[model samples]
Target chain A: MATKKKVTRKNTTTNKAKAKTKTPEETSPAMDNPYISASFWKAMWIICSISVLLEFFIHRHKHFEDLESSVLGNISNWFGFYGMFGLIACSGSILLAKGLSVFLKANEDYYDDTP
Target chain B: MRIITMTLLNNIPPAFLLIIGAFVLLILPARARKVGAIALAFFGVYAVSQLVEGSNVTPEFLGFDLTLLRVDSTSKSFGYIFTLSAFGALIFSWSERCRLQNTAALVYVGSALGVVFAGDMISWYLFWELMAISSTFLILARNNKRSRLAAQRYILVHLGGGLVLLTGILLTIHETGSIDFTKENIYQNTVAKNFILIGILINAAAVPFSSWLPDAYPESTIFGGVILSAYTTKTAVYTLVRGFPGEEILIPIGCIMAVYGIIYALLENDIRRILAYSIINQVGFMICGIGIGTKLAIAGVVASTFCSIIYTSLLWMAAGAVMYRTNKSKCTELGGLYKTMPITMVLVMIGALAVSGAPLTSGFISKTLITAAAEHQNYLWAWLALKVASAGIMLHTGIKFPFFVFFNVDRGLRSKEAPRAMIAGMSLMAFLCIYLGLNPGQLYSIIPNSDILVEQVSFYAIYIKHFDHVATKFQMLLFSGLSFFLFLPMLKRTRTISIDFDWFYRKGAKLLYSGIDKTFNSINRAAEHIVIKTFLPSLVKFIINAPASLTIMLFRPIWEESLSADKTNIKKREQKIISQFSSGTFPVAYSAIFILIFIAILIFLGRSLS
Candidate 1:
């Protein structure tokens, strides 16, 4: 290993930056994992409750108009019944993808680019 | 012009032409095969031109019963570009004439042509699968392990998608009793709409299913790469416009694919894979257009489709040319090539900038329509997302591909320019890009309800038309340009694989196989213990002891009584057992029963573990 390092070092014009890429073999205790970060859940809770509030207002409006999609096109199209549902659905899918990414995350060397 | 009315029928001309081309290549000499492919390209071009120039609401083929080959304006425009794509690829491949390559690629191109031209669903499906298989062999003809593996994977994916399509078609037929390819009103049931859309979306490289195109394309042979770029995803766009033009879900799906493809491309190392992802990115704009479902949006779809076909072919040609000259692929290993292969470097740079939507290029004229339509609707979030993605495109593809391959720090390669045939083909495409960009009116004429409306002055004309109101696109172009140069320091050639949708299947399959293997091994060990510890040894002991005891027992009983009772207990048992064996063959049956009892004891022991 030392000999291999010597060979590479001879080729490089400088030896300083090489230490950064010679990564530690095991866990690095200092680096924070984003999946476990407090802010992630905090962000999710805030956005989701906000969405629930928006859904409440939308339903109250839908009760007044009594139309499902309101084909009137501009102002009334703002708070249709489906609009609230669509936003909730979007949030669900986005969070699911985020959850999946965390569960499926691997070490930095996951797949080698060159065979 | 008089519009001709005729019955809905399908033509066998294109299919016959393809088969005949394959047969000629197989039997004829190599030179003849090259001539045959060129002639076929001209034949297709003439037919397509007639369809495009003629003024008609609908057209038909004469042979297949009631199957249509009608020419809607949108379809006619697509057919024109498909033919041109075939011509460009055919011209580029003229230098090499491997028999299977020629046969398969011609059939593949013809099959795509058939799909584009078909007016009904059944005929469209027939050519769709044909395109899949025929193009797969184009990859296989490269005859390397990687290429063969890639070919197999490509076929697997398309065949799987074909199954989904088949189920959808069967259900649709059962439900509607009509297989007409005219714009489908399939939103009657939500579940059925999802089934039909899933099948089409798979082919369009919508996020989860899109990895296959980039995964398979880089491994194809050079000429095969050109044809590979053109067909599959575009067919999905064709089907989308046909089936679900105004469906609301596609807007987000297309938006995701547009941005996802660009980001992955930023991480991509292979030149062709970069182009492949860009194909998805380019198609995203079209998909978004189809979602808009207005006349202007359809016009946007038309222009984007036309531009995508030409630019994609050009980009692939550039990659192929580089691969042909220097066998090295990774951008890190390639540089300083432009100084030697100046023609290649220049044509490729043109292609690169066009993909970036540089002004006075094909991309500039075509991509604006969709983004303009989005802004026209005041879809502020959607518009911002698309604009950011367009700029990202310049970062990933427009600069990375040509910049890395041609202008990177020199790696000492001094290869010559591409073959004359390749250069000529690229020149043809380059000329078309500039010509169309300068006079987009030529292309706009073919678009329904929009003709000769692409004057540069019209960009600032007081009208609210797309060409007039493309200020944001110009901003994207400028900002992307500035960002690329500013972030030049951040750019470096590094080898890395982006974890795409394929990573899920690849890594998940590995874990699944290991789990199943572990379960099977435990079951096998339990069975082995039962057989070894009890069944086999018990059978051996029964055979040996039974024969000896039966024969000796009779004599031992007589001798024991005479010899005296002194040896008593131990001797008595042995004598009795020997006498029993010597007496009869009944001892053998007794021993067999004992063996069966021992085997049952072993089974009890194994069961006791639980």
Candidate 2:
């Protein structure tokens, strides 16, 4: 019943900007540069800031202990060891995608308007 | 111990009642069935809280196996809320006559109940799939082409997750070799750990695979949408709590979902679709609590799981009401509905507040705990993000939904409120949300740790006491004040469907599908053209020229005379045969075999899983 053209646009640019603010890909959706979108750079700084805070402050607890017995405990030792590495490696792929976007992106409509 | 045993005993009667309800709804007369379902559902709900005897209560049938029919405080609470979901769903479907819908919803709930109480992975898997299949039937009962397609896609994604889950199960069994489905932080084998995480994340409707929900749900039948709101995803949530609590990724994934849902919903036109996305958002909170992985956080997840069930169903109840009455769900098509359907409007507003995590609603008690848990874990960014998204929830669900659907200018039409049963069904939930929020201590007791009560009870008290806390007293006053101002600009009557993630699939991928379809079709035509017009014609000319060329091929004169007579009759007969075989449709055997082979593939899949 309602038509799209009749619906007034409300600062589409700003609205999209706001939506991007909380998006999960805010830091890096692609890999290469990882800083392609200005918003993503800002989100990264935010993450780095918070993660630094968490590691330094909250993790400063004496609860961390090494288990010398039981098979389950030994198993957790490996996961704690490897899972962190896995996360870091996966994060690299994301960073690279962001960087590579710079080279692949061509002039607007390189397929059509240029010709 | 006695308390656990009694609770286990309490659960058995309801299980029997539901198993019976599942069959009765299929075999009985329609009118008689509705009444029977309601009565059975009521008693089943009552038994959830009444029969609890102890904490480690297991009920075994046919010997020696321990089945924790009633286990810990958390399981009991989930079991109780799931029963509540079952009751509400029964009432919502009271007038819905699709026998398949009723039967499927019944067994779906029972299977989910089984999952919650299951003490083993094998049992959980059985119930997990039962929920998936029965729920798919509910979607298919909508009996539309779109729903049928969505159902197929839905099954594919879930079945994929199921396979991954099976893979995880096998690996875990190989390593730990234990079937006990209790909590385990066994990320010992990285491969098995990631497999389980991926499998779990898929069902949790975390990224890349979240499309099935919003895509399939809105296409479901009238009340089909109701039961779809529960069971499947939450069962996955239950599994995550037991299997992978305190895992860090769930925090980020869940937070992403919380914000993702609101943003996409902000752009969506379909109310049911928006609410479907909101289900992910709510489940996100539960998963986040599990990530925090503490006593308070688990309590938060359990309470929020129940709140999501109640509030999500309530939101759908109102949206489904609008669709049922007007046959329109897009916000652009709906407005000023509050004038005609006051009760629906009021219930919708209440549902909206609960959804926005407004103070003094069920959401407040359940959702606040999750945010607090994140803060306790010192996830400051997540904390800040969740709070902003909380406000965004207000904008998207709380304000935007009600504002556009009801409060926007009149569309020059009138509509009736939902059926009496639907209204009664929603009212029960709206009442509970407030009842639980104001009296959160009542809810806190069911959460496992004793320490939870001491910390949370006081926290809720501060909020409750702030301004004549009569549950709705503070909420109503606060909401009216906020809604009257912040949502003013968004409430303008001018309208359009905001763009969303589905736009990539619904519109963009649709364009891709159609483009690919056309390209293949034309390529097929071009190939046909080359073969039929060129190669086949050349072959025909060659065949005609080869042996039958001229006089030699024409046999001797006398033999030719006899053959000509015979050939003339044969030509006539052949003409008649051609006329008889010609029909303007695919042969019956063609369609039958095509469908049969298609089903054959599904059967193959089922076999392969074993």
Candidate 3:
């Protein structure tokens, strides 16, 4: 997604002056206000760390205790399985959505207006 | 039978109060209308709250007993939420001057309550159609070209569903000679049952027919969209629970809808359209629960339905406030709205977390019931799919909605806060979302059937003790959030929509209509050629020549006799004939003269009329 930055003359002049002082890469729009900033990712890392560690101490019970537990089930029983599964599922779903969009995406005006 | 004193007053169904309230609001002076509507909401809630199960009021309609008001725990559970939603929506739309939108919204909500309370199939059908028609006006009330078109499509799809449902009801009645709204021995293979299921699925926004929800909902007026998000699908869920619990097929259908909604929402750019898709995804969870058919599962369906109605409506209301203030709906066109509209953003976040099943939120408690039920039933595949879908929900709705609309790169747009009325309405629902989540006993107590209630209570009591289950859910959601940032590039908003089965009807129907038109045109063209090249000219020639030819033939014999009598007589007759027939081809000339005169006269008459 391209972020729309309104470039007024005053703002442009300030940016140009700043460009004279700062490196071009630092002045790039993408670097200036990234959608997910370094600060946000830092917070995310901390949250993930806490949650990943917390998974170890939690005691969970299964609804179907009598079901034949297998290797996959045993693996899921390990700590952080849900976290790992979620990461994989989320990534997979995003990729799947992107893949589906290749076939299903169309011009927003696919339905005409004249009726 | 117990004797009742308030036969006329108390027996009046809450549905009628709302219907009557709509008319009363319409008639009251403009200054008094809002007050009148608020009063009606109060009365309606009170009326519904007072209703007792099994104390049905049956009215005779065409020699059949019509259950106009069948109060039960199931009906009351739905009634409580429906009336509550109406109250919130009424306050949300308090500033609306359009009487039609107001009245229609009331009728729409009232009819949903009626469907919830209806004890007979015929009355259900009547209230069902009333819902379809009245809700349509909410879309049409926008009165713009897009809304007009969307409203038309919306009604057509609903009417189509309504017809299918009416067909099912009629068939069931033919087979069983009863119209009571109770469990019937409808087999999976039966045509009537399938018809009924498909009809309800259409309203539920289940797969194949699901596109209508996204197609039409985003186009409604703000309050209209808010009210619309509440009743239609939830009523269908209520009906499904009443009509077909444990059907088994709904499990797969629901699972598909759950994932399908996520994929579509992932690709959507419009904020409200994303919310609309989430409605489908959330309902899918409920439907899956209903399919499990265990007491816990059914309770989950009812509880989730209740929670979904509030949280989804809140999401829409918050999004609507943004659109109202900024006049932009597409995510690509919105960002940093939180700067000016902080309250709206906070409310939306609350709705978002609630929908994502965050701990101590309505969705967490309600969704667990279904997932746990799937586990108890040993439906491993369903349990896994639902868990993944749970993660998917957090991705698409819980984060995507607020991230794009409020927290993304600044679009440099500023706006005033949402109006107080809208804020009040959202706050009420936001409070309820947390209240219901933190204390689910209030919600569980309302689920129909005593047996189900007991099971639900035990399930609730036990589920909280499972630290692992709660921990896993949090891990999934937190990791899902992590995945979202990792794949942020792939999830960029785009100004495109994913085409679904509606393509068949929206485009295919256009193709079919034009094909019919082309066929008619070709037939018309062939007829035009025959008429113009052959029949028309021949008829014209005949008409012109016939009169002149007939006159000439009739006078010829008399003229010949006069010519033979004397040269002097012949000379005068020949002079007269020469003067009249100066052209060499006299009959052809006469035909032309007649044709010109006939055409001139027709033109003269045509001109005179104008």
TM-scores of chain A in all candidate models: 0.27, 0.27, 0.61
On lDDT, the stronger of 1 and 3 is 3
Chain B structural similarity (TM-score) per candidate: 0.80, 0.76, 0.83
Residue B406 lDDT (model 3): 85
- The alpha-carbon deviation from the true structure for residue B75 of candidate 2, after best TM-score superposition, in angstroms, is 1.4
The list of candidate 3 runs beyond 4 A from truth reads A1-33, A69-75, B1-10, B185-189, B449-464, B515-610
Q: For candidate 1, write residues B470-587 as lDDT tens digits.
A: 3333433444544444344445435555567766555666667778898899888877888888888998888868766654565477666777554666476676666665565455
Model 1: per-residue Cα lDDT over A40-109, one tens digit each: 4465445444543444332221121333343432332343223233333323323343344445344435
RMSD (Cα, Å) for all candidates, in order, is: 13.4, 18.4, 10.9
Off by over 4 Å in 1: A1-115, B1-16, B52-68, B449-475, B520-610
Tens-place lDDT per residue, model 3, B1-610, is: 2236345545888888899889878987775888788678777877777776675688899889998888878888899889888888788777778878779888999999899999888999999999999999999999999999999989999999999998888888888888877767334228988898899999999998898999888989998999999999999999999999998999998899899989999999999989988888988888888889888898888888888898898999889889888899987787777788999999988998999998778888789889988988887778878887888999999999999888766676678999999899899889998988777677877875446555335435635665566677888899999999999888887788778777878888888899999999999999999989889999987875665456556656787786665757755655555555444345577679768989999999999998
lDDT of 2 at B501: 40
* Candidate 2 residue runs with Cα over 4 Å from true position: A1-115, B1-17, B50-70, B455-460, B464-610
Better of 2 and 3 by lDDT: 3
How far residue B303's Cα lies from its native spot in candidate 1, in Å, is 1.2
Per-residue C-alpha lDDT of model 2 across residues B428-523, encoded as one tens digit per residue: 888887888777788877766646557557544637343222332222323332432333433332234333344455456667888999999999
Please give the ranking of all candidate structures by DockQ, highest first, separated by commas.
3, 1, 2
Docking class for candidate 2: incorrect
Model 3 collision count: 0
lDDT (Cα, 0-100) at B437 in candidate 3: 77
